[model samples]
Target: MTDRIAMIAVDWGTSNRRAWALDSDGRVLAEMGDGEGLLKVDAGGFARSFADFAAPWLTDDRVVPVLMCGMVGSKMGWAEVPYIAAPADLASLSRNLYAIAFDGPARIAIVPGVSCIHDGVPDVMRGEECQVLAVLTQRQMRDACLLLPGTHSKWVQVKDGRLDSFRTYMTGELYNALTSGGTLAQLMEKGEADPEAFRRGLARAREPGSGALPHLLFGVRTLGLFNALPRAGLSSYLSGLLIGTEMRDALAWSTARAVIAVGSPRLLENYRIAAGEFGLAFEAHDNSALLPPALHMIARDAGL
Candidate 1:
């Protein structure tokens, strides 16, 4: 690749797509964002979408090398890049990447997602690896636990800047399903993050016992029905239950002292609250802060 070659890094998930054109130093030269997420675009129209967003950079002698992560590599995505199992470094991830040609002028590379088998459970992650790589680049820790809060939250364990293992929780998805789905959906009003109710839910989740979640959820519903819990607090209560349960499960396997959470401010704030409720120390890093560093790591690993 020539020094003039523009490198584009993309993070495409289910609902949104982001692209950055970077110089050799990995500084963002130009950026584009759109709602043409993998789930929303037709497989055949991927090239068109790529061309439309990247047309400006494709001119002249700039032969762009595009590196993408997230659902773009999923079975339901443009192309399925098979996963690289855990205990992986940037090199391993780069080696496992799937490349395909677009009839367009640019060269495209899709970063393969990561997966791992732990005690017979198959775990998978897409865009979070970039966040992990970004964390390793930014911090000097020898070992750490990174929590990525989103629709599918990931608790990743890293040792010496390499991914050791991780787990995924369906916290956000469950929250959405319960809020938008049938009968029980009408029981609560949304749009408020009630800290008090959240705290109450967190306390209930921290109680000792393996099977307390179901009973607790039942009680939440009962409280709503009997005018015990305010309708406005129901959303926060449910959020706490899901996140708190995740915290319980994450703490079971985590041995790291410090936790770095990556996500939006609202999500990270919730994570901070949950961590505090669990007596764990944590620092929140916005997901966008990791983007440029992750692109640099991808360049380094791919020798771009």
Candidate 2:
């Protein structure tokens, strides 16, 4: 009785995966996901792993189109789908899909990642493109500056509904490394998220001679030691310092006065606050909400 299901769209990342079964009109009939991301998927185990996770929807005996986006298309993922150069649009994305032949009654296609050169260095994005495209199409916008926050955050610029160019920031990863038994780890791990302390870190990053990141980072420890910053506020200050630095540098990546960020509320809050400091209006879209229409659009345009 469930033959109306049209497509299975997956936003699979390195740390998590989510899939939705949608009808032709893009209505979600069921949703499934788990923390067993690409890292846990053993070599050559993607077929079984996908099958197990999609078992419920696959039971209908109909071969539906399964479009996967994110790190699942990376070299370490199920298959290394070649990245298409930037100024990319959904049409190019749909056309460049790498199809995987599965024994299950399903047609699987991996959405290739988008790549571009920034500051004369190569940069790329896998899963975030889906959200970017979703924001573009769903919002019916012709141009905007978009931000996707993560371990490697992205600053994207869209022109005429195409991804013109983008740059990646390792803010999250740096914060993790600094707090993972590193010099600043002890103090940063002691506190709740402190807004004012975070603001201080942000302000410090903008100081006249604060260009040297090492100097600014060392202040995290010294401030705590000197009782200038509280133990319970150290983590927040560190987060602010890094995010503030990222804002100072990345906000110039696009000329748009306002930035639309795609992430959950908790994640977007920091960026929103960062935007206010930099004097830019911030808009937010739920990361999960972007996948369904994005996949459906690609599949439809590709004539799948």
- Counted clashes in each candidate structure: 0, 0
Candidate 2 Cα outliers beyond 4 Å, as residue runs: none
State each model's CA lDDT, in order.
0.83, 0.88
State residue 58's C-alpha deviation in candidate 1, in Å.
1.9
| Model 1: per-residue Cα lDDT over 168-239, one tens digit each | 998998889988875457888766679999988888788887366667777678878998889889889888
Regions more than 4 Å wrong, model 1: 1-5
Clashing residue pairs in candidate 2 are: none
Measured by TM-score, how close is model 2 to the native structure? Answer: 0.97
Residue pairs with colliding backbones in model 1 are none
Model 2 lDDT on a 0 to 1 scale: 0.88
| TM-score, predicted candidate 1 vs. hidden true structure | 0.94
Q: Candidate 2 residues 182-229, lDDT tens each?
A: 768876546468899888888888677787787888989998789887
